[model samples]
Target: MNNKTTISSFFWQIIKPYKWWYLVMIPGPFVTAAFVFGYNYAIKLLLDVLTQDKILHYGDFVYPVGIFLGSHFMVDIFFRISNYAEWKSQPQVRKDIMCKVYDYVMGHSYNFFQNNLSGSIISKIKSINDGYYYLFESIKHNLTAKFLISLLCAICLLCINSKIFIMVGLFTVGLVIVSMTLYRKLGVMQGEISNDYHGVIGLIADNITNIANVSLFASKKAESQSIINHQENISTPLRNKWFKLNFITEIIVTMIYSLFGISVLLYSIYLKNSGQITIGDIAFTMSMTFLFQDNIFGLFIEVKKFVNTWSDFKTSFSIMQIPQEKIDKTDATELKVSGGEVIFENINFGYENNNKVFTNLNLKIKAGQKIGIVGSSGAGKSTLVALLLKHFKADNGNMIIDNQSIYDVTSDSLRSQISLIPQDIVLFHRSVGENIGYAKKEANQAEIENAAKMASIHDFIETLPEKYNTLVGERGVKLSGGQRQRIAIARAILKNAPILILDEATSALDSETEQQIQKSISDMLETNKATVIAIAHRLSTIKHLDRIVVMENGAIAEDGMFDELLAKENSKFKALWDRQVNGMVL
Candidate 1:
């Protein structure tokens, strides 16, 4: 579909829910039109009365003036009230849109996040909010106001002598031509330039978020130069766009002003000679012409503003329409994870047309089995767990849990049975209590403390003056690497899912701390009878696991008990185990 159709459809979907606001706001323009007619007619009345005598009569104008002034005041009040109403309605609209976007983002599988940066997504939402608010407010206020005023002014001009009315009409027509020309030639170019400026802002956001990395690489100069290049690209076209429109608008304004001046001056002279009209008529017509021209100019300005904001609004709306990963029905049943039996039968998958990451991968773990997955960096160890969790759909075979196909279950139900602890830990910028409590928001203080103590972090937490109340900076930056990792582990432990997947969960801790945390993990899971699937680079971490599966070049090369693999010299697991043993300093 075309952009306008897409934007309109999305916009209507949002606006439908706020139908009350739409009902109240739709009449705003008619109120404005009434005000224009009342005020303009009042001016005409005053001029007509003045012509009857050399001086104006206050008594003759008293009632008409009151009606005129009263209408003006009431219209102003209604305009303000309507504008306020529309403004207030904006947040509801924004909140609804943002809530939908939030649901969409959160419901997406892990791979979706891997493909998109967190900071960039945030920047996109911020930009969308700004442009959209302006977009709707401009349509409600400026567009309506301009249309009503233009229509009333046209009627006022036409009621005057037809010849002069025709001249004013032609002048408005010429201005429209100029406006359309400017819009056609320069509007699209300006829009592209504006987009480039926004993209530069996105780049700056990304760089600031990674400032530590930039400094570590000592690439400040290169980064600055790159920013400068983006700035220049934005600035150059913006200057040209403004220059083109300014030159055109200036010409239109000048021509209209001169033409009206000449028309009034010549008309006054002819009226004086013919005695058909007086100085009062001349003054009134001149005043009306200037008023009419002002509204005409305003109409063009509002049209220009509409074009600019519409383009921005369309871009934001298009982004909002991007399809998120599917969510299932509320009634979709949850999976039974008590058995903790995960089976991947001949599963094969790839991403973005790359070479297959998993080919005919088959595995089945009995209930309560502790399996260790060992693989090189790109050997698809993580991809295997990801498939079991249904992060990305498999191209072949079935991933079954408790004899039920994973795809048959809802995402929430499937994921509710699994707990994942990745190597890098991420925590929100909140108190330790809140971050840990995130896994289960309704968790009580005792539950929180017990989980922390089980993860062996309660002592460290208690050392702080505020204990669990201490604030962790953005992404838990204030915490040390090991500390953040423990918080992540604490979260997974608290979740108490039946199937635990640890992708190097203890990689950050020292050897001594790693051993302690591993023992705690074993004790805690045994007490709860939870099964664990772990991927570890350090073979020592998984020495106690029930089975060790070694992966090489995206396929499982060996699988058996750790001691059995160690005894077999030709097994790939033995080779990796030997390398780790040889690398350690005795």
Candidate 2:
């Protein structure tokens, strides 16, 4: 869409809901403009009376002064009403727009988050809110008010002399043309500058988030220099271009308006001296001319603001326009998982087209079965879990849980039936108990403690003075890797879903801790009778599972019990087992 249409539609959407408040505001500028016209007329009457040859009376003085004061009083009252209406509406408008933007961003698929920087996303959201708010405010207070007053002044001047009206009109038009050309150029520069700012923010966020890596590598100076270079490369030239254009535009506008004011004053004097108009007419013409010039100049400033705000609005709208990666089918149903039997039927999938990761792969797990998936790094191990979670749609075939095709169910409902304990655990910056309770928002203290105890992290938590209330810093950075893993396990246990997937769940723990946590997990699985799928690099971690599946390339190469697979010397599972055992021996 064109910029004008986009901005208009955006404001309409935000303001549509608050129609009543805007209605109250609509008459404010008109009333104020009328008062300005009336006040100038009152001044003209006083000037006529003063210049008349007849003896002046106190009554003549009282009439025009009273008219002027009355007009001023009405202007003051209407202006307050307008300001009040704006004050009432702006906060609500800002809140509603921000909430809509936030909801839209939250609904984007996992892939969007993975590909975009968190800091840039945040900056865009803030810019959208601030831009829209200020844009609307400027429209109300500056653009609308000034336009009305300028029109009223022009009409008043036209009554005095058509030539003067023509002069003022031409000057206003020239000023607008110049401003628009400058604004178009400035908008482009501003958009580029905004992108540079986003880049710098993203850079800082990335470095701070990975501060541990930076410190370990002792690259702080390098990172700082990189940030400085980015700023210099992106910001310096844009700012210089912006200032040069802006300065020239201002100088031109000032000169044009100043000359227009002088020409009008000189013309009004000539008309009076020629006996073609009275002194009262000259007073009216000059006053209207100055008012018109001021309002017209203010209009240029508002136009600049609109252009800049439009740039920000376009950036925000670009994010809102992103197509959702995953969408629910119209006929999708809420998944009702029972026993959690999972089947991958003739699946063909890949991250990119022409590079298949799983080609016509099929697998079935009976209800309540414990299966282990083993493969080297790119065997589509995590991809399988991702497919089951519906993070990505398969290229062909279906994933069925409890006889229901996953694609036929709502994602929220499908995901509600499963729990995952990922290898890299990241907890919210909240209380320890709160993080664990996130699995079930309504879970009570007893349930939280029970899950923590089951995950074998209860004792460590209890040792802290705050116990369950102890805060975990960002991404659980205050805790050790083992501690964070246990917290994740606890969260999964609390979720109590029908299907559980352990994606290298115990990889972070020491051997002793790993064994202890494994026993806890085993006990939970047995007690809950949940279907389990464990993916592991450490073969011993899942060797005790009821069944083992070895993957080679994009397809399954071996599937059998742990001992059964190990007995086949030529099997992929046996090869992986020998490699791990021999590496330990070395």
Candidate 3:
């Protein structure tokens, strides 16, 4: 959408849900304007009463004083009520918008996340949240109240003298023109400033997340200098420019207000001295002019803030507007896994147009078959699993599980039937039990303990002071790589899906631990009659599988029983096995 459309829709989306609160708040600005107008009139009445030489009774003096006090009290009450209404509405509005934005971010496709920075997305979320309130405050309070007050002041001045009215009108026009011009300029600068700020945040987050790597590589000094350079060379300079512009705008606005106030005051005094108007008229004119001057200053500040916030709003909505790349079909159904049989037929897949990973590939596995896949780094090992799990849509293919096409099934259901133990295990900063139970959120402590035991990590967990309750730290940094891998295995065990995938699952474990876990996995598969697919670089990890498939450039180079492949000296599997055996001997 265009900027104008996006801005309008964003505002409406935030406020439309809580229509009642906004409806109540609609009159707040008008009431405030009325109070300002009434309070000035009250002052005029009081001045008139005090200046009158012929005070026949004390009631005249008391009446004007009482009116002034009463109006003051009423205005104060109205202000309080208006503030209370705003306080009640704003928190809920902010919370709802924040939640909605979070939901949108979470729903984004995997590719979207791969291309964006987590810290930058976080910055956008916060910016949108603050921007919404800023814009709302500007429109609901400053814009409405100031406009009404200015109009009332202009009318009052016209009644007193057309010359005064004409002067105020021209000043208003000039103020608006200047404010608009400044607002546009500031918005462009603010957008640049915001981008630089996001970059700084992103850099900090990236450095912190990889702090271990930096420390291991002894690059802390370099990283720190990089951050400092970003701050000094980009963020700091842009911020200075933004603030300077704002300061200049404020100075100009204040000067205009001062000039307007001076002109009105002189005109009012001249008219009073000529006996063309009373002291009351002079008092009223000066009071209104001073009030408007304050309002105009506040209005300009709000306008500037609104402009800056508009930039933030646009940045946030740009992310939200990204269409989901993977969406379920209208007639998608929940996948039913009867035998866990999987087949890939006539598959053509690629990351880019010129780089096809798999072209016209075909593969099939029978129910409860333990198949091992071995391939080079980019030979489509992980990509094969990803396609079966529907992480990415195939360029042209049919991936069928139990005679049901995966594309015709809901992604959640299609994935629920399969459990993957990824090579690079990433654990949340949570307790051991919590991480284990992630596969099944409703799993009880007993189930968690059982899964851990099966994965052969139960003994290690018992050694820690907090045991199952210990915090894993960010990405499971508190634990060893082997421990993290075991935790992931425990999670997959708890999942207990019909189809299981082991992508270098034992890569981090020591030889003894690997053997124990492999035995446990083998037993589990036998007991459950599960279909298994293991992708590994180490031939030892998959040498005992029921069937072995060696891939070369995304095509099946060799497919046979492990013994048969080993017997063939010319086979790719035999070549990989020879390399590993020779390396170990050396």
- Top lDDT prediction, candidate number: 2
Tell me each candidate's RMSD, in Å, in order: 2.9, 2.5, 2.3
| Global local distance difference test of model 1 | 0.76
TM-scores, each model vs. reference: 0.91, 0.94, 0.94
Q: Write the per-residue lDDT of candidate 2 for residues 1-586, one digit (tens) a residue.
A: 2223454675688889888889988888888788888898899999999999999889888878988888888878887887888889878998988998798789887778888888888888888888777777787777888899999999988888999999998988888888898899988887877777776777788888888899999999999999878778767878898899999989998999899889888888888888988889888888899999988898888888788778756765677767666556879999998799999999999885467899999999998899999999889999999988888888899999988999999999998899999988998999999999999989999999999998889999999879999999888999988888888888888999999999988876788777777787877776778899999888988866899998888899889999999998799888898998999721
* Tens digits of lDDT, candidate 3, 422-451: 878888988989999999979999999998
Q: For each candidate in the order shown, give its overall lDDT on alpha carbons.
A: 0.76, 0.86, 0.83
> Which residue runs of candidate 3 sit more than 4 Å off their true CA positions?
1-5, 79-84, 509-513
Candidate 1 colliding pairs, count: 0
- Which candidate order results from sorting by lDDT in descending order? 2, 3, 1
Residue 228, candidate 1: Cα error in Å is 1.5
What lDDT score goes with residue 199 in model 1?
66
